[model samples]
Target: MDAKLLEILVCPVCKGLLHLDKARQELICRGDRLAFAIKDGIPVMLESEARELPADEEVGQ
Candidate 1:
């Protein structure tokens, strides 16, 4: 992901800062416990498209 884009990206629901999980290729919103997928380098920011993070699931750095 582009640094500038990452800086501006946030959780759609909570407006919380997101962490790019490179390994998983997902934008992780810890505050909302959601993981937005990155498909073909574009983030799927739609709430319905986001996957809820399991209670014990850890968001990677």
Candidate 2:
């Protein structure tokens, strides 16, 4: 993921800050409990495309 893009990216649902999970290739929204996937270096920010984060998942900063 591009560093510039990550700085500007936010959760579509909550318009909140996102934490990039490099290992998972996903942008995590703690507030929304969603994970937006990064496919081919592009973030899938659509709510319909986001996956529901497991309740037990740790959203690390």
* TM-score per model over all chains: 0.94, 0.93
Alpha-carbon shift of residue 37 in model 1 (angstroms):
0.3
**CA shift of 13, model 2, Å:** 0.7
Task: Report model 2's TM-score to 2 decimal places.
Answer: 0.93
Determine which window of 10 residues in candidate 2 has minimal summed lDDT. Answer: 52-61
lDDT (C-alpha, whole model) for all candidates: 0.93, 0.92
- The weakest ten consecutive residues by lDDT in model 1 span 52-61
C-alpha lDDT (0 to 100) for residue 54 of candidate 1:
92
Q: What is the per-residue lDDT of model 2 for residues 1-61, given as tens digits with 9 covering 90 to 100?
A: 9899999998898899999999999999999999999999999999999999888978868
Candidate number of the best lDDT: 1
lDDT of 1 at 28: 94
* Alpha-carbon RMSD to native, per candidate: 0.8, 0.8
Q: 1-61, model 1: which lDDT tens digit per residue?
A: 9989999998999999999998889999988899999999999999999999998887676
